[model samples]
Target chain A: DQQVKQNSPSLSVQEGRISILNCDYTNSMFDYFLWYKKYPAEGPTFLISISSIKDKNEDGRFTVFLNKSAKHLSLHIVPSQPGDSAVYFCAASEANAGNMLTFGGGTRLMVKP
Target chain B: AAGVIQSPRHLIKEKRETATLKCYPIPRHDTVYWYQQGPGQDPQFLISFYEKMQSDKGSIPDRFSAQQFSDYHSELNMSSLELGDSALYFCASSFGLQKGSSEKLFFGSGTQLSVL
Candidate 1:
């Protein structure tokens, strides 16, 4: 059972445009969500995260919005750049669950310059 | 400082053979995690070690085991490997397993294992 799901397998957008990736979760116990970006032959790097207490969090050009009632979350990258092309994974964990995370299948983002 | 480092960037083994992968977490980090990633799929959790003890284990088979030493280094061992075990293995670390905190993870380049 995949508690976290990223429905879109891939996405393409023009450079300098806003790129949105969506994720949904079924576990209500998950209180923290995170996004990671990975390039070919490399490990995933941390991008941004959001807490259940807050609805939105922004860091530089990346913004994460959460909707508790709908059990949904999204990551928005503004002014997408070619370097931003990679696989984005959404993960979640409960506070006392020993920080074990359940991850989505991941969405491949391609930015065309 | 260096991030997580995994040794043996690539390895090949035959069925029923044993393979070992090593990982050194970031200096001073207490949490180490192992994950397996297959082609066109996301990474799946295998196990985690904190402070030299097994913290959690995923639904992986018994053939897969992990150990952590005092210096915060970890090792993954696979006995009687099967073709299904062929994939990319990753190691990660965090300061602590706290929720709602930075909880940022530093990952290694990964070890590509091919079981023949």
Candidate 2:
């Protein structure tokens, strides 16, 4: 069973525009959520993360918003650059669940210059 | 500036053959985790190790085994491989889990294994 889901398979946006990627989870036990960016032939790289206690977290040009009641979260990249094109994956884990992450099918983001 | 290192970047094996994948964690990191990503599928957690001992288990098959060495490196051994075993295997490392922290992991480039 896929506890985490990303409904959109791919997205395209113009450079310098805002790119929004969404994710949802069914497991209420998960208290930690993370977003990773992966390039071809490479591993997923840590981008940003948010804890259950907080509703939002921001790092540089990336922002993550979480809605506990809706069991959903999203990642937003401002002024999207061509280098930002990659697969974005959403992952979650319970606080004491040994830090094993349950990942959602990634969303491919393409930024056109 | 060191990151997790995975060897052999690519490997090919036939059915029923054995394969060993290695991982070298970043300096001072004590935790290691393994994940597998198949074609058009999300990454699946395989197993994890902390301080050279098995810490957590996931959907790892019985045909596979893993262990962390004294040097803090880890290895995954797969025997009796099947066509379904073909996938991109990733190794990640962390400094250990701390409560109320980000608990982010540093991942390697990954080893792509193809079983024919």
Candidate 3:
């Protein structure tokens, strides 16, 4: 059973425009959420993360918003750049889960320059 | 800055053959994790170790075994490999075992194992 799900398979955006990727989760035990960006042949790179206590966390141009009531989370990249094109995987882990993350299927984002 | 290290970036083996993959965690990091990503699929957790002990388990197959050495290095041994076992195996490391901001992982490039 998939506890975390990324509904969108792919997304396209123009350079300098905003890109939003959505994700949903069914496991209430998850207390921490993270977003990772991966290239074609490389491993997933850590982008940003948010704790269950907070609704939003921002780092540079990347922002993650969480809605615990809805079991949903979103990652927003402002003024998307060409380097932002990649597959984004949303992951979650609970306090007693021993820091192991459960990942979503991932969303491929393409930024057109 | 040093990151997680995975050896044998690529490997090829025939069915029923065995393969061993290695990983070296970052300095001072006590936790290690293993994940597998198939073609066009997201990463799936396999197993994890903390301080040379198996701390968590995931979807790892029964034919596979893993261990973390005292030096903080890890090895994954796959026996009687099948065609479906071909995938990118990634190793990640973290500083802390419990919650509170040390759980973030830094991953290696990964080992792409192809079974013929």
Give the candidate number with the greatest lDDT: 2
Compose the digit string of candidate 2's lDDT tens values, residues B18-88.
Answer: 99999999999999999999989999999999999999899999999999999999999999999999999
Shift of residue A40 alpha carbon in model 1, Å: 1.0
- lDDT by residue (tens digit), candidate 1, A1-113: 87899999999999999999999999999999999998988988889999999999999999999999999999999989999999999989876877677889999999999
* 1 versus 3: better lDDT goes to: 3
Q: What Cα-based lDDT does every candidate model obtain? A: 0.91, 0.94, 0.93
lDDT of 3 by residue, B76-107 (tens): 99999999999999999988787755346889
- Between candidates 2 and 3, the one scoring higher on lDDT is 2
lDDT of 2 by residue, A43-75 (tens): 899899999999999999999999999999999
- TM of each candidate vs. truth: 0.96, 0.97, 0.96
- Model 2 misplaced regions, further than 4 Å: B100-103
Candidate 3 off by > 4 Å: none
Query: What interface root-mean-square deviation (Å) does model 2 yield?
Result: 1.8
What is the lDDT ranking, best to worst? 2, 3, 1
- In model 2, the Cα lDDT at residue A112 comes to 100
> What fnat does each of the candidate structures reach?
0.62, 0.60, 0.67
DockQ values, each candidate:
0.65, 0.67, 0.68
